[model samples]
Target: MSTESLGHNSVDARSNGLFGVYVHWPFCAAKCPYCDFNSHVHRGAFDEAHYVEAYAQELAHFAKHTQGRVVQSVFFGGGTPSLMDPRSVGGILDAIAKHWIVDPKAEITLEANPTSVEADRFRGYRAAGVNRVSLGVQSLREGPLAELGRKHTVDEAIAAVRLAQSIFPRTSFDLIYARPRQTLDEWQDELTEALWIAQGHLSLYQLTIEMGTRYYDLFRAGKLKMPDEDLSADFYEMTQEMTQKAGLPAYEISNHARPGQESRHNLIYWRYGEYVGVGPGAHGRLLINNQRHATATEKLPFEWEKRVHARGHGMVTDDVLTWEEEGDELLVMGLRLREGIDPARFAKLSGRKISDRQINELKAIGFVETLPNGFIRVTDKGWPVLDAVVADLAA
Candidate 1:
């Protein structure tokens, strides 16, 4: 089979937007203190075969609603999708092909952790039709890695990245910044190393404390000291400057990619295109019977499987969205891109145009700028306060 072509072209992306499938693998070896995602750590025996069957069944159920739509991307996200046997991954892909007309050029990605054990599966994943790998190499320093509860050493992380680059057509890694006690110079050095080793894409995120996590409890107890707002702003600005200088500009608030090497799967979400989320604790948006519906499944792994076996799918929520809600979602998601939102598209979805008064107010303050093509984008000056800008426009 021919490998999917790689290029960073927005026209092709927009023209080909279709269904993106997100399959969640919710098991992890250990849970990170800062994570609030719906992931669980199972020390007992795992049943990969059983979960594979459940995924196939749920996908078949979704196919009935999304018939005739060509699939443009498939992403395996996880507590640890890398932990699954490659054969299982292949089985899921085969099931997807059975139900949908998967575009030959569709991008297939799997999220992995940078550890030797996981690295050992790189070739297996490649054989299973995964053309892209996103590594969770959160930091390059040992102290921070230990603090973050990551099992991999910095050396192991780098080695895994090298091994992944050798096997995958596209590679990307994630880094968490604004960490406690991290100096700006230290972060600069770390980022320099990251850029030196980076391939086509990188996801740089600032650490945020979420409720119901260990970090949140520690923070509430005043044990975890994160960067202050002023310092975090400095870190954000420096990141933009470094990444832009390295020729990998910010395509979204937290993602940097070589012009066409952007993750097509993620783009579907940011662009508000339809997607089907399968497996445990996954969420999806789809056009069902001419109405946009939001869907979510049971988060517990075994429970989800039982639900699927009993009722064809494990979905617990399937609320149809109002046009006003769709417009709000469009505004919230589209503004994250550097390319910004098309007012015409927004008007089409919302039935009301964005207030000219708000646009002028934002433009006058240098928070936003209008392109020659008429799309309105948040300025570099405006990105730090993106939420406020979107809320203003949406209001």
Candidate 2:
């Protein structure tokens, strides 16, 4: 495609007013047993150059549709972006700049496994324009790391975090709590240490077995023991309390950050802003012709590459969402934020207002509350049953 043809089309007044890009690098050194993300462990020789070229092509294709949009955030999510050569990461960022107007202060984040080997590449990634790094330090204990199929040990993970903090402008790491046989006291100790080590942000998630994961099979076979409902609730509450006391409050359901340290890229998603997703199994929401289109690329890595080579894009589906669908999506994503959703925006997008009776009922039951600023958000009591609350509101 010619550069001229990829330039911005006529601007739409009904745009979401924010835009970003998501690049999916779908390769991993080893697949975690609990992971259901679209990541594959390739056995044969991989051609990094060819993959990089395909990414450039696919990005150019997306640029044609989303021209003139200033990129506020560019996320390199993965299988493990740290596995990539820094030059490859640089090549993709260069491609994005070539196609779109990247903001000078755009948050360029790359997800990484906290292995010592990958941590060695920290300086290279920082030199290549990655301002932020989110490490996959799933556990700080050896036994749980092994159980989760993570290749890094506790010492290595901590070292990686320290190294990343020294190298990058912003750094965040994740941890999984409420594992089988885990006690509340143990978790409190662990979280206390995590809070002490955390620089500005942390992602703490409760372990849940998803179908098609090895953990799910083990759970179904009764070989895995998970925390029961009450204990899980205790874990969640304690996590909230500790993180809040540590000065990193929960910004979303699973994310915590100090003031102004929230992940801007993820906030784009939670705020229902527009983004282009390029690469295998990536999904995007774009505003086109005054309508929101949901797009998804082919899932298989090699197949997506082939499609991109042939068609300049790897998209497998592009559906124009209805107003109701748009409103529902806004509710689903926006409610996860502490700032909550704007009912006016919801009405503008969905063409209807939320039922007052439903809101009154939920408020009476203490599931949700209307902020003084006129935004509606799930309360602490409501977060445990968030899906049900959303369902009721949507209904």
lDDT of 2 at 135: 95
| Model 1 lDDT, residue 124, Cα | 96
Which pairs, if any, clash in model 1? 7-260, 8-260
lDDT of 2 by residue, 1-395 (tens): 23342335637655667899999999999989899999999988888988999999999888888878899999999888899999999999999999989999999999999989899999999999999999999888899899999999999999999999999989999999999999999899889999999999999999999999999999999999999999999999999999999999999999999998999999999999999999899999988777788999999999999999999999998888999999999999998998999999999999999999999999999999999999999998899888888988998
User: Clash number for model 2?
Assistant: 0
User: What is the Cα-based lDDT of residue 347 in candidate 1?
Assistant: 86
Which segments of candidate 2 are over 4 A away from where they belong? 1-10
TM for every model, in the order presented, reads 0.95, 0.97
- List the global CA lDDT of all models: 0.91, 0.92
* Candidates' RMSD to native: 5.6, 2.0
